[model samples]
Target: MRIVACLNGDRRPGAHPALPVSADQLAADARAVVAAGATWLHVHPRDSRGGQALEPQVVTPLLAKLRAAVPGVPISVTTGLSAEPDPWRRYDLVQRWGALPDAATVDLAEPGAVEVARLLADRQVALEARLGTVQAARILTASGLADAFAYVLIGPAEPTVAQALETVTAVEAVLDRAGVALPRLLHGREQTAWPLLDTAIAADRDIRIGLEDTLLAPDGQEAEDNAGLVSQALARIAAHA
Candidate 1:
């Protein structure tokens, strides 16, 4: 199982204060996470003014910088359709940025998911299909659009380890029926982060963690930065490995 780091672009510190918004900070974080045993990196580029908006002009340069920093790491960017109502407009950025990352994650819960998937496929960008439930997985499988699959397990207001494991089992069953032969990355949000990592490690699925997913380390303390979070996750994986 591989651990991927999610570099959430939100800098204001909603859930994770360690998430880096500046390009220089992101580049530095990328290096640290790579050193910490993360073979993959997922990023959401903030606007030039330092806000969460997937503007190609903003993202393209950041992607270039990240590529320079971590040459071999497979990087994936977020095309958050839920951030915008119109799917076509959301996709326009992907079309505009001719420079493609290794993969792009598309949320199946969003509107025009099929269309977005088609656009991604047309551009030859590998897809990391994301879902929060079995229904969403079925939708993506039926549409025949996803190149890879992931289940985003949203933690409860106060999450528990058992709850995290249950969610993964449910999603795994759903995918088994769907018969999708794609690499799977499993993760959880908020309080469920560490527990989900445990579950993912047990399941032998690709696991991800970073400031974007949770600010606190597994020990239930605020992470100093993305590097700290990655280091902690790497230690856990090594113990299990």
Candidate 2:
């Protein structure tokens, strides 16, 4: 099970003081995670004010810095509609991305998921299909895109550990029925993060962690930074291994 380091999400500066907002900060975090055993990297580029931005001008520089910092690590960026509401505009932004990422995520629950998947596939970027519900899994399966996309099964952040496990089981059953044999990356946010990782480790699924998922460590203390989070996750995975 590989560890995908989500360098940052659409998280604001107030989300975590150590959250990487600028390209330089992100690049440094990327290096630290890679050194600590992260097999993949995911990031959400930000504008000057730290808001999520999908335009080429904002994304390219951040991606370039990350690539330079982490050398051959597979880097990906999110194409979530929450970052840009207009579906057509989201498509256009991805099409014009200056420095292409190794892969990009297309939330199956999003509005223009099919079109965005086609666009990314055409550009030769691997697709990481983010499936939140059984319905999302069925939708992607019916779209004839399952064979080409990896899957992300993220449990909700709010639920109790038992509820979260149930959610993961339901999604996994849906994907299994759909015959989704592609790579599966499982994760959760906020309070569910560590428990979900524990579940993923036992299930032998690829897992992701970083400030994007939670601000706290497994011991319930705040993480010093992304590197600390990655380190703790790696140790947990090692214990399981």
Candidate 3:
């Protein structure tokens, strides 16, 4: 099971304030996370004004700096539809940057998601199919485009770990039936984060944890930074291991 730390690029004060906003802060956080048992790093490049923008100019420099900071750690970038509404524009950014990370996670719920996945595959970019629901997981698995799989256990309406696990189990079964061999990364969002982490660790599943998923630690206290979150997650995994 691999633990990946996500460094949110967007730095909204009230919204996930623990996320690293600047490139230097992100590099520092990545180094700490790597030392804290995280073998993979997921990044979202922030604009100068602290907004989530995946411009080639922004991402290229950010990737270069992160690579220099955390050598050999597999890096994944988010192709979040919520980051940008227009699929064409987002596709343009993906094309222009030619800045491929180790992998890219594409949300299955997004518009034109399958098309985007096809494009990513055509470009030889590995894909992490993001499944937030049973339907979405079915759609992704059915499409047969994912090189890897991840389930986002959070939604606007809070769902229980059992519910999320049910979805994951079903998706796993579906993928098995489809003969797909993609590795899975399971995670939760907001207040349900630790519970889901517990679920994944108990099930011996790979996972991702960081400020992007939850600003609060398992103790119900706010995390000071991304490294702190990674440390807490590592502690949990260690105890389970």
lDDT values of the candidates? Answer: 0.73, 0.85, 0.74
Ten residues in a row with the worst lDDT in model 3?
A: 148-157
Regions of model 3 farther than 4 Å from truth = 9-17, 146-157
Off by over 4 Å in 1: 9-17, 82-85, 146-164
Candidates 2 and 3 compared: the better one by lDDT is: 2
lDDT of 2: 0.85
TM-score of each: 0.88, 0.96, 0.89
- Per-residue alpha-carbon lDDT of model 2 for 1-241, expressed as tens digits? 7798887787877788889989999999999999988999988888998888899999988888988998999988899987888999999999998689898989888889899999888888988988777677778779998777755546454457777677678877887887778878788888888988888898888999999988999989999988999899989988987
Top candidate (lDDT):
2
Model 3, position 37: C-alpha lDDT score: 78
Q: Per-residue alpha-carbon lDDT of model 3 for 130-157, expressed as tens digits?
A: 7776667678767755443432322222
Clash pairs for candidate 3 = none
- Models ranked on TM-score: 2, 3, 1
**Residue-pair clashes, model 3:** 0
Top-TM-score candidate index: 2
